[model samples]
Target chain A: MAKRLQRASETVFAPEDPEFQIAPMVDVLLVILLFFVSITSAETIKARPQSLRVLELPVAKDSKKKETSAGEVVINAGWEDGSGMLEVAEVSTSKFADPDRMRQFLRDAVKADPSLRALIRADRKVEYGFINQIMLVCTQEGISNITFAVVDKERQG
Target chain B: MAGGGGGGGEEGDYGFQIAPMVDIMFVLILFFMTAAMMKVSENELGIKAAGTPTASQEAQPAEIQLRIDADGTVSFNDRVIGSPIDDSLAALRSRLKEAIDLFGEKQPVVIIPQSTVKHERVIEVLNACAAANVKNLTFGGGS
Candidate 1:
């Protein structure tokens, strides 16, 4: 019956060519590229500055192990000699080191996501003056949820 | 041409091998994934930092004020307690717990840290507030 069905077709078709499938390979490559591009960008946005990367975080007995959620903007700060520097999402400006850029970023972020929260990671030796600047910026942008990163007091080493 | 620069005569039959390119891309992706995962996770303590509200003429509730000085001294309601030398602010914690018991967790608590105060000292005060389960927490000026 299969031979009769094949014989019934009057159309003549081209012969099947055996070769490497480049189209599927290209699709796989594109998918892989997209995956890494997205992942690396997210990690880069969450990256901290050098000061916050190595500084000793303050110890707290009540710090909770909350799973980090989306819509969080990390602000890294450091202060010395009556001056301070601010880095939002690992970006620091060459000009006078002001929070104007950070303020604008926060405003836009809050507009995009009303649930945006600020996660401040500052050095232990940094002065409150700097941290307050970050808090003021957050409040001004209508982001009332402020989180501070700290080490567990029991793990003081 | 001796250096095989644009000679176009060696293995020209194979236009481009996707196999080797794919291998290299996979390795690069693995490297970046590991680097991103290496970032250490940190514990977080949060506060709802809102703007100061305008004063009302109606009868108002009592507010608890905690002040931190530049020299690491912490004052609760104008009375100094807890030595900054100790890591654990046990005294301040107990007093804050007592205040919560009386005024309830909804009572407003303001933390005022001086300009030059170290962040570590300020966090100590916040630690005490967290232990006492203070719900209405805010940051205020160093008045």
Candidate 2:
């Protein structure tokens, strides 16, 4: 009985049997790495620059799923806190200011890449007139491919 | 027994440490997590900004006029369809579907929104058109 007890103690106290196996840990780490990499890549297309102001986009239940192409130009329209003018792509344009410069910029961009699409990211609180004005400018610049950026209703929560 | 055990230990055994590998994996995991969290998903609704078709051009498809007032009221062809309080915009959807059925998918939809109308209300009208499978959408000044 004593010999059996000694053998059992030796088996219990064996140092070679590690508490954690490296193989399973490695497998888990690899799976996590793959998951994160895929998720990051999937969301990278919509990532906006930090310098751009955050606009509360309107929610649309039937908004189509579209990938913004490489040459697409994104225009952000929102109200500036201090100035009562509409902010279009970081430029402040009041109701009186002629949008000739903005239109010229868009014309030059479209001239360079005719296939370039225009995306308008308008704030939810913004008036519809502001968006219409921008759309008119795009049409005048010969850019027919215009899109409005919005948030999916399901994702709003 | 000691000599035999010593000889056994000398057999084809190369020591490989796993601690450093685990540390490196942890660093990689941290980096990936940070990158994933920083990315955000952006969605878009396609709209074509083109001038009104002139009479010189080919026969244009039937055009449906939609209007939104500042108080979130939606109207179809000068007839008020739904109010802002209706979250689903059921009436607007049904009317737009009827228009789509009559004019087919090639029907042109022109949205005339008041200058004071909220952006959300405008999107609601656009969503109704999208649900009805109306592709050719145009934005026009208040009528």
Candidate 3:
């Protein structure tokens, strides 16, 4: 029966030499390229310069004000001297120079006040590396209570 | 599957494989590479210390968690304690002076900073610690 049908449809034609064309593939690729470019470029949020403002913290009512007799520790930033020394009260402290001395001073402060917390105020120009140094001292001395002082943006222009 | 690109001499087959498939593969590879690079660069915390360490002096290990934002704000644990940055350096100094006295022993304080946090801010924190005479420093990655 199949042979009879084939003989009856002898007028039908098919391509004897067919090959793949590169043009169609190129068209498909162009579509994909356009899709990607449009999607990636459509994103609007680019990383921008961060503006950091340091604010002031409220004073604790129960915390007592203890006077320092071993002189002051100065942790001043943005000084022209380039020395990252903090003045404790009025005395210049150089505990930053040596890790051991710094640790000793921290230990002493903790001994003086069992409920002691450190409040660090950094200048706008001071880098993170400098801040890490202070964190190191706190962790080493076991002074867990820490606070940062920032200026209110509304007040600082 | 093969032919052409040989000065049209070796084989009489002009019907060579299409180069479009190769171009698509290259594009896909490029896309994946970019995505991977972005992920790695997102949390680039300059943590000098990673693991945990026991201090020589403290019998009980104390945890000192330092929080650093992009601005110059530093927080220990969750509390925000301090005065205005410029004038309050002394106030900070006095606070640390007291804290150091309370700890009374050597313990490792861990500094965990954020990825986008600035370098100068970290330095100021360290300077404040030094002013308080607290030492023994270690670093960890930021949140």
DockQ of each candidate relative to the true complex: 0.32, 0.42, 0.06
TM-score of predicted chain B, candidate 1: 0.63
Q: For residues A1-157, what per-residue lDDT tens digits would candidate 1 score against the true structure?
A: 8887676663345456787675687688678767766766653234457543355678886878757657788777766556776666535533234666677778778899999888887778888887887788788888888999887743333
- Per-residue lDDT of model 3, residues B1-143, tens digit only: 22334234457654544554556545764785464334211111112233334455436446566666655466666555442254245554565567678774353456666744554455445555655666555567555
What is candidate 2's lDDT per residue for A31-94, written digit by digit as tens? 9989988887775344342343567788786887775468777776664552213334423332
Write candidate 1's Cα lDDT for B55-122 as tens digits: 55554358888888778888888898866685678888898898889878667788998988889999
TM-score per candidate, chains pooled: 0.65, 0.69, 0.30
Better of 2 and 3 by lDDT: 2
TM-score of chain A of 2: 0.64
Stretches of candidate 3 off by over 4 Å are A1-157, B1-58, B82-88
Cα lDDT, model 1, residue B108: 79
Mark the regions of model 1 whose C-alpha exceeds 4 Å error after superposition.
Answer: A1-46, A50-53, A80-82, A90-96, A153-157, B1-41, B52-61
Q: How high is the CA lDDT of each candidate model? A: 0.74, 0.72, 0.47
- List residue ranges in candidate 2 displaced over 4 A: A1-29, A45-52, A81-98, A154-157, B1-40, B52-61
